[model samples]
Target: MQNPAIPPLASEFSDLPATASHGPLRIEYRWVNETAATAPIAVFLHEGLGSIAMWRDWPQTLCERLGMRGLVYSRPGYGLSTPREHDVKWPVDFMTAQARDILPALLDALDIGMQERTRMWVIGHSDGGSIALLYAAQHPDELAGAVAIAPHVFVEDISVESIAQTKQLYETTDLRNKLGRYHADVDSAFYGWNDIWLNPAFRTWSIVGELDTIQQPLLAVQGHDDNYGTMAQIDTIGERVPHAQLVKLDACGHSPHRDAPDALNEAIATFIKSPSKAPTSTPARSPK
Candidate 1:
């Protein structure tokens, strides 16, 4: 069964010109709750391995709950977006590049001018979550608020270990094949994320210093039992951004939207309507 009031998610593509550093990018983005009257835009950025399809109906449901229009998009090399070359490697600053370059460019190509951006909100998960933090730091004036779920502001041993296990699964199991369902080039997406994270040089990666520059209200969520990152991620966010709200969830893991959608939804809605730069009425779970 489905609710008629919920707007069905639909996707569109745009061909963006090449940058001096990278080649052309064809971005795939979807609209959530399109039937609703004009409202704030909630932009969703997916996990490293995630794509537009990986989000399923969560974006639509979240947008419906908040009476906002949603925009969920796959970064280059994910979903139906342009794929990365098989031999090329992602730089350590890949996530930074996305927040600093790709996001702004994508919005520009979509005709979402600078003025329209001020009212928009960004909700990002995992790697996307990190990018959201960077985006806020990069474009502080353009966003109303941001939600970062299970975001990694720095490298950790647990993250490296978990990613190593996933890489092994990709080699020895059907993980690659399964990922193929969501990524046009699963290798491109997976390897791009994996190789960079596992790189020894990335061990010192940290966004904590950069977080202090973000001027918008932020909601950072994390699961107590997450294997990929610890509470330090979101906690540090609040420490850096004085107005940032921290939500720590119980009986949850890396993905909050999947593990506790109702609670996460309520918490987010409460934060958005709270009318102040303060703590959330409730807490958080996982986001996928």
Candidate 2:
């Protein structure tokens, strides 16, 4: 559950006009610690099947730990935002469109100008992580830094197999019912992400070349037990951006925020304070 105590800074619909390839969108977003007038902003990007609500209290917790403000939102097809058309299939470059177009427009609509952007940090998970990296690459000067957790730079067989299994679970189990709590149109969110990953064309997708242009601080994190990807994801990131800090959590999985919040928080806090230095992983806490 989202922390009810943290007040909404800007939680309204931002109307996005229809483009050549896609329909109009109304993005839903909220802010954390908005009263921190002098603090840098940390934007939280959700995973493939994620939303503002799905983030629970993690954003607030992280923002408080880092002494920064935060922005959390659902992408167009998830949460309270507009749903994808029933007949439409997302393009192969859908993530690219999200990074280059949707995010910029949302920030503009929210009145986050170049000055605010200069101090902004993007922290994302899974698909959102990939988007964060792409955003940092495209607008390196606009952001202070980025943290990508369980991000995929290229397609992996494990990713496909896991996603395919998820699709089956969504169909055969109560997974859709569970996900329905987070998304207004659960099918839209599920299939949009599911169909794309299973698409054969996406197999050739790789974004390593784009990392060459990123100038801001970057931290790529992965878990040893992640089912969706391997250490090669962050390892490849290290290969591209030698200065990027890498963290591999012991006893953690794809979603570190959930699987190992204490360790993730400590690493992020250390990295934000010292970009050039590598973060020392905290000992994993016992599960509740």
Best by lDDT: 2
The digit string of per-residue lDDT tens for model 1 on 213-280 reads 99988888888888999988887887788778888887788988888787778778888888384454
Q: Each prediction's TM-score against the native?
A: 0.93, 0.93
lDDT at 95 for candidate 1? 91
Off by over 4 Å in 2: 1-11, 279-288
Residue 278 CA error for candidate 1 (Å)?
4.5
Backbone clash pairs for candidate 1 read 255-286, 255-287, 256-285, 256-286, 256-287, 257-286, 257-287
Could you tell me which residue pairs clash in candidate 2? none
lDDT of each: 0.86, 0.88
Q: Which 10 consecutive positions of candidate 2 have the poorest summed lDDT?
A: 1-10
Cα lDDT for residue 240, model 1?
Answer: 83
Q: Give per-residue lDDT, candidate 1, residue 143.
A: 94
How many backbone clashes can be found in candidate 1? Answer: 7
lDDT of 2 at 113: 88
